[model samples]
Target chain A: MKAVLGNMRAELVGAGGVVERNAYLTKRYIWWDVAWFVWTVANTLTIVFIAKGIEATGGSLDVNETMTTLLIGAVVWAYLGILFEFLMETVAWERWEGTIEYTFMAPLSRAMHLAGQGVFAIAYGLVRAIFLFCVCAFVFFSLSIPDAKYFPAFVVLVVASISFIGIGMMMSVLPLISPEKGTQLGFVAQGTLLVVSGVYYPVSVLPEWMQWIAKVSPATYALDGIRKAILEGQGLSALWSDLWPLLLIGFVSIPLGLWVFQRGEQYAKRHGKLKRSG
Target chain B: MTNIQQAAIEALPRRTAPAVDVRDLSKEFRRRDRKLGRFAHRKRVALDGVSFTMQRGETVAILGQNGSGKSTLVRLLSTLLLPDGGSAEIFGHDVVRDARAVRRLVNRVSVEASFFKKMSSSENLGYASRYYGMTSRQTRDLIPQILGRVGFPPDRRDEPMESLSRGMQQKVALARALLTSPVVLLLDEPTTGLDPRSKLEVQEFIREIRSSHDSTILLCTHDLAEAETLAERVGILDRGQLLAVEPADALRRRFGATTLEEAFFAATGRAFEADDEEDDEDREVFA
Candidate 1:
């Protein structure tokens, strides 16, 4: 029992150290962080403005209602975007810094290292998403959800992050084995999720095949739950339909992600791809 | 306290164990056989049944040209790469099965030693120390002291690693390896690309490390003089095979050559200066 406790304590300390190191790196590359922030804000604005543009051009739609829906989509998309970027770029950043070998060779288990990254990504992504949401809300003053149950919406978003992190963990292996196209492929994976998850349009509007894809995506439920909680002011009991799926996916994905990454790591070592840089 | 002193204080009870032991170790890499109609594959042997052992506190150097599997051996022993066949142990801990234990015991310094480029030398060392489970209190004073001992200029310790010269970066690498006071140090051409003065300084530091600590060193290098100067045993590895491992004078006498370079030629039937870069072109690609 004492030995197990000691081991657990070591793992926690090791994971914390990885988080601390990443925080230092983030501080060192403050410009990249700033640039990403600006890009996300611009991206959110671009989508939200389309609704405004429709209003300006005298479209037949209900302008205020349409704008509010678009604002929700924009805010949700911004949150998911940061989440995906943080998770997917985990290995790419290590490669860029040339610390992949050292990091891998450290005594810490793979579980601890990746869990550290996942935790950092979620924390950092939440902060960035909140900032983007605030800035967008300020710019689009008329964007308001009539009954905003923010607590449940926030819970859904947090739950959704677990699945996204698992997916990100899986994607990180792409770079570990193939330094050339792994990172680009990660973004491609994110783009596919975006198209299917109804980040802008309702899932019903998507093609039948895309709706099927969305059925498996935790982000789909996340978006649906958040929209209901905010747009309809639904309580936790009302959001159970979306919550269960998110929970299931989160439980499944974290372990699957870790397994896939471990296999990729072993394959990379065998093929001498771990330290290969283009 | 200096790392040497710290190592002694925290040292585990010594046993009658060799620092490293290997038996019939082999590694094969698959490469694309472009010459065989572009889709064919072949196995390129990196290490072929290589076997050796090092007693504790001994310094052994493996001399090999590029592509001669020095790095592969280091990677295998360091538990970064698993062997295709055979087994290796660090102080009785199997490298593959007990990788975590082996990792705690061995530290590697390579020419390709990587750092968080955005972080300063001190930060990099601090990160490594923490990973090795060093407390903040120990690292606060120990990191700068280690850097200083490695001949890194105190003023330059805080500069971004990207801005530092390769020589300075190599110093930081050495400092990181020493930070944990590893029992086995695997050096894979640690001074390959440094200037002569920097190379000498690193070599001197390696000598000091051997003398000051109860650590075994395995240095892999192409520099013949370096192998002769620092290591008690100089090994000649050629084309994935270890030809001989002996003292420099014994190697020269066994090959009936006047110098270590000639001894290398006598054993390998190739000039020591020959470029082996083209050898990689025929490697087998694993799908």
Candidate 2:
């Protein structure tokens, strides 16, 4: 038992090293981080403004409710976007820095390396998402959710991140095996999730086929649960329908992501693609 | 041999095992044949049935022109690329079956020594130390010590790696490799692009490392002088095959030539300076 615990502690420290390296890179490239933050804020506000535009154009819908819905969608989408980008960029960043060979050659397990990346992405994405939400709320002073159940929504978002990370892990391999189009393909996967997960609209309003895609998407439950808790003041028990599906997907995706990534890594090594630069 | 004697030999300490043992190792790359106009594939042999061994604390240099399979041989031993056939063992650990153990024993320094360009040399070294499972207390002092030994300028250690010259960067690469004191060091043209002064400094460091550390060194280089000066036994690799591995004087005497260059020409029937054009057609696919 002691040996097992010691092994776990060692692995955690190894993973922590990966996170530390990323933090150093982030600090060195502060401009890129700032630029990404600014872009995210602009994207959120643009989506929120569409609701205001509808009201200004004399649409029949309740403008306040529509704005609240739009705000939730925008904020949630930003969180997911950050999560996906960080996770997918895990491999791409290593390739760009030309450290992929050194990093892979290290005497650390792949699981710990990826776990470190996942932990950092989740933490960084959460902080950025919260900041973006605050900025959007302050800019649109009229926006309010009087009965917003913040705790349940936060919990749901955290749970949803697990599945998103798993998906991101799977997407990261695209760049590992194929540097040329892998990163762009990761974005395409994220975009597909965006369209199906009903980021700006209700899933019911989607075409029948896409709605089926939404059914399998962990993001769908995340959005649905967050919207319910904030807009309808739903409790944990009431949001169990969304929570369980998220957990199931989380359980399945994490292992599947790791497996696929391992396979991709093996392929990359076999084909001498680990260090290729275009 | 008697059964008792065989058992006794098997019971001997593994520390006596050769630091490196390669047997019939081979690697082939697939490339598009432009002569066949695009879709036609060709198998280009990188390393062909090459076999060699190095004792502990010995340095062996493999000399070859560009694309002569020196890099491929180093890559195979380091577990960076899978062999198309045969096996390589580091301290009796198989490169393929026991890769994790081999990784713990081997450290590679290549011509293209990659670093996080945005991070400082100190940070990069610190990160590597941690990955190698060194405690923070050990790294705090050890990183600076290693950098100083490699002759990296102390004042510029904290500057971003991108701001440093290529020679300075190469020094950091050497420092990173030595931090863990790996049992096997595979250097693939480590001083390829350095200035003459820097190259001499690096070569001097390589010599110092072999004396100071109980490690085996496999250095692959195209510089005949570097090969002759640093390694005990110099190997000539041509067209993916090792023609001869012997001391510089021995090789010259065997070919009845006064210089190592003439000896190489006599062995391979090609000038040592001639480029292998087949390398241009070699293509790699990531997928």
Candidate 3:
């Protein structure tokens, strides 16, 4: 028991140290920051202009309503962007940079190393999410107070993002296994999630079976939960229905993601893919 | 903390074990052809009946061109990939059975190192150091010193990794591998694509580490000169076969050739520069 505790302590210490280092490294790359800046400016300007036109010419629409709707749309879009970024920008980027082999060679488990990489991506997500939220609130919602339900909404958003990121990481590992075939599967998965998540519209509009699919979709949990809290002024009690599902999705996806990633790594090694690439 | 004190501590006898061992180890991969249907796929032999052993502190160079299973051998021994046919042991610990133990003893550095492209060299190295269990202060102080020894430009330490030249990036990789200084060092074409000066600097660092520290080095490379300089014994690997292992001079004399290049041709019936056609779709195994 003592040995186990010592080892765990060592691992935790190692993980903490690594996080600091990665955070420092993340600051050097303007890539994520620049990407967020461009996305925010583009979305902000478009939403403001569109809302302006909607408010013009004696439409009965409240200025607050138009602005809030635009804000909700922007936030949802940014959240979706975060999901795909995990796949293309973080996991896939590892392969393109030829660091996959290096990670395989490191002292820590591949899972932990990937976790470290995943943290950097979460940083990117947080930056974009907060920026969008702030801009929308200040310009459109009069810096409106968050509903009591916002805490639950934020929790659901985090849970959904965590689950989706795992899925994205799993898909990223596929390209390493079979470049051509794995990539095709990745595209299909990405497109399917996008269509099913109800990012741009409400899932209630979908057909019955499709609505079920959206209910279980990670994006659906995040988008719907946030839209309810921020736009509809829903409270925490209102989101209780979606809470357990988000937790279940997160619990199941994390393990599955690790298992699939490890399996893919073993397959590549057994087959001598490294040598072929060399 | 001091050099002499550390050496004395390192010298205290504890255990004697072969740093690495392998028996009948083989790995095969399946590759599908998209031009054809799903069933129109095939299996390729990556490491076929590969077997070898390395004693502590001995440096061995496996010289092979692309697709000769050099990196595959390194990966299996390091526990990055499991063998399909046989077993491998590191320090008497099975790579598969005692993988966690094996992982603690080995560190691998490859030519194509991946870094957060937006991060600077120091930041990347610090991250690797932290992952290996270094504290913040140690990483902060140690990374710059190590990078300096490897000839990394001070000014470029804070620039994004993508902005650096390949040669400079390769130097940073060598620095990262040395950060933890594991018991076994596996370098997969470590100097490939490096500029002449950077290559020499890295080679010198490897030599320094081997002599100053108790490390068993396994280097896979296509550079004959590197094989001669860094390894005490060189193994010629061709078509997943280890044709011979001996000192460079011995290998030349055995083949009745005066140079490593000539001996390679005599042994493999081809030039060192010959292009290989074999491709394995087994990368998913590593994913």
Candidate 4:
């Protein structure tokens, strides 16, 4: 029992260290982050403005309601994007910093290292997502949806992050096996998720085959649940159908992602590919 | 600590076996020849049939020119690279089978002092120490202490690593490795790019580490003087093979030469200055 506790303690400390290093990296590159955040805000605004665009042109859609839906979609998309970017670029970050060898050879397990990175990404992504959502809804769009239940919407966002992180973790393995093109390949997963996950639109709009693919993406459930909660003022009890799938994906994908990453790491070590950009 | 933890700690000193036991260790790289054929590939044997052992607290230097498998050997021992053949055991823990244990026992300082350049020196050290299981309280004291011992400027601890000189960066790297007092400290050309004064300070710091810590040092370098002065035994690695590993004086005597440089020439059958594939195409297959 004592040994188990000690091991847990070590893992926690090691994971915390990974998060702390990233925080330091973030702090050091604060200006760059700010620039990216501004870009993200603008992107969010452009998507949410589509609702206003339709209303301005005399479309029959309810302007405020359409704007809120778009706003929620854009916010979730931004959150998921940040989460995936942080996790997927983990290897790129280590290599760019020329610390891949040191990190790979550390006593800490790969799982713990990734968990620390996950913690940082979730927290950072959530903060950005909240601010983005606020800017798009209240400041820029002046969206006021009566009877909207925000608490349940937040719960959906929090739960959905688990599955997104799992998928992100799986994508992070690409750079380990193929450093030359692996980082670019990570975006393929993101792009696929974006296409099939119904980020800015409803699932009913996608074709039959694409809708089948959308069913597998946790973001599909996430968008569904958040819309129900925020637009229709649904509670968690009514959102159980969406919540369980996210939980299941989180359960299976995290372990599967860890397994895939370890295999990729072994392949890298055998091929002598862990060195920085070589 | 539990009984298991206590037992593991107590069993750390396997005096019966060498601190590092590498047997017939080999590693090869598969490189493609785009100029030759579309699918043509050849193997470069970076380390071929190399075997050595280090006793507890021993400092052995492997002197080699560029691409002579010095870094490959260090990387293999540190669990950063997998060996193609043979086996290496660190204090009874196999590098492959018991990599986690070996990782705890070993730390390496490579030729390039890699760090998060945006972070401060203290911040980098703090990250390293924490990953090795040291708490914040411990690193708070140990980071500055280790930096001081390695001659890092106390005033510059908070400055970004990129702003620091290469010599200073190298100091931080060494400090990170020694933060946990690893049993086997692998220094792969730690002073390779330092200026003369900085080189001397690094060498001095290494000697201090040798005397102060119980760490067994495996110093791989191209510097002949560094091999002679810092290590009790010197090894000459040419191409992919180890020609000799012995005391500096003994090597010179065996080669019937008055100087260590002459001994290197005698063993490798080439002038010290002229030995290498630096300018050549290096397309030769190892076999």
Q: Candidate 3, residue B92: CA error in Å?
A: 2.4
DockQ of each: 0.54, 0.56, 0.40, 0.69
| Runs off by more than 4 Å, candidate 2 | A1-7, B1-13, B33-38, B276-287
TM-score per candidate, chains pooled: 0.93, 0.93, 0.82, 0.96
Indicate the worst ten consecutive residues by lDDT in candidate 4 chain A: A269-278
Q: Write candidate 1's Cα lDDT for A245-268 as tens digits.
A: 998999999999999999988897
lDDT of 2: 0.83
Sorted by DockQ (best first), the order is: 4, 2, 1, 3
Q: Could you give the interface RMSD of each candidate, to one decimal?
A: 2.0, 1.9, 3.1, 1.6
DockQ, candidate no. 2:
0.56
> Chain A alone, TM-score for each of the models?
0.94, 0.95, 0.78, 0.96
- Compare candidates 1 and 4 on lDDT and give the better one: 4
Residues B127-196, candidate 4: write the lDDT tens digits.
8777777789867877888899888879999999999999999999999888877888999999998999
For each of the candidates, the C-alpha root-mean-square deviation to the true structure, in angstroms, is 2.8, 4.7, 4.7, 2.6
Task: Please provide, for model 2 over A190-233, each residue's C-alpha lDDT reduced to its tens digit, 9 standing for 90 to 100.
Answer: 87887898888999999999999999899899999998998899
Using DockQ as the measure, name the better of candidate 1 and candidate 4: 4
Model 4, A70-109: lDDT tens digits are 8878888778788888987778778888898998888898
Stronger candidate by lDDT (3 vs 4): 4
The top-ranked prediction according to DockQ is 4
Off by over 4 Å in 4: B1-13, B275-287
lDDT of 3 by residue, A1-278 (tens): 98577556556655665466546645655586688667776776676556567668656665665566556656656665555555543335555656655555555665666565566566667667777777667754464554434666577677676777678678767766765466567667766775677655567777888888877677677777777777677876787666667778878887888788878766666655433342
Q: Residue-wise lDDT of candidate 1 within B1-287, one digit each (tens)? A: 35543543354334665788888999988766788767887678988989899998899999987778888899888777879999999888898898887887788898865888879988888766666666667788888888999999999988999899898899999999988888889998999989999999999999999898888999999999999999999999887888988999999999999999999999999888886555643331211
True contacts kept of 3: 0.62
- Residue B191 of model 2 has an lDDT of 98
